[model samples]
Target: MSADEDRDATAATPPELETDRELVAIVAVADNGVIGKDGDMPWHIPADLEHFKETTMDHPVIMGRVTYEGILETLGEPLPGRTTVVLTSRNLETPEGAVVAHGLADALEAAETAAREHHDGADRVFVAGGATVYEQLLPAVDRLIVTEVHREPEGDTFFPDWDRETWTETARDEREGFTFAEYVRS
Candidate 1:
């Protein structure tokens, strides 16, 4: 199937959209496609951290179990001021203030609902990632707020390769360690 046909088929398979929420993938990827080493981020750029916090601050963040676990390990809780929807098939007890979802549809639903009630009418669901989540949701993402890290560090997990033709770069900012870039699906 062509891109349009494939997209059309998957677009309708969903969490029963009661509202249209922009699905945004928020990530920092190294030049060699590394996004993570083990369960933590490969690099520690404070600016990128701040950037991530600012961009996804008021929106519901949807991430896979591993990603959420990484946050828990480092911060002892979910990021403050955002509803976290943890998507996983396995049963695991989540900490307070975190929403657990067993599937993609449930994850999106939880994010959408949280965005409606908690974020004061925010309409974007940011997809935080551990690789698999980003890979699975790439096709559906409306926009990408990517921090393009300059170094190529070795890593076990990698961000999925996306076609540049599918997105149009809307903005770019050169930072100390990385270039912050935004792309909208075209």
Candidate 2:
């Protein structure tokens, strides 16, 4: 190819790719949507654990630094097929298999890159987080898989608010100690 033709081609922006995969928010909360207490989960629902594992097995899961740390401690690190991105303002490094991002945008960029590199479009990039991370990506997430544990546990963290009119519940099933509900934007 001619140099001028090559230059023009390089300068032109390529058409954007429409991804079928969506950003998902996966959280376990009370009926009131309270998530955490004293930097930890307040409930001991084993069913919720299996549900979380099954849903996020091969996806890119995003979270705040503390949430990432908590998951590593509680769940014994993310599954082998998943990419974990942690958002933080502190100068912290990710563990061997994890990736570190400075903010929500950075995390999303990292997730997109991972999606392209991994070539897994059926899986989503999940924003699984602390309250601030949830609030930041709440408007952009396409699906919410929330496990509602019927309890009045005290919490310093809360889930983002969504209008019932705008979000439709796609699934509602009770398993042992919790009710798993999946919501999709309208």
Best by lDDT: 1
Model 2: lowest-lDDT 10 consecutive positions: 8-17
Residue by residue across 1-186, what tens digits does model 1's lDDT show? 122334432232233433388888899999999999988888899999999999999789989999898899899999898999998888888776689998777888888889888999797999899787887677678888999999999999998878787679999999877899999877
lDDT of 2 at 102: 78
* lDDT measured at residue 164 in model 2 versus the true structure, 0 to 100: 66
Which stretches of model 2 miss by more than 4 angstroms?
Answer: 1-20, 75-79
Alpha-carbon lDDT, every model: 0.83, 0.75
lDDT of 2 by residue, 1-186 (tens): 211332221121122212345878899989878999877888877778778878888678888888888878866865467788888888876665578887556788788877767636646887787887876666677788999898988888988676667778999998766789999876
Residue 144 local lDDT, model 2? 86
Pairs of residues at least 3 apart in sequence or in different chains that clash in candidate 2: none
lDDT of 1 at 184: 89
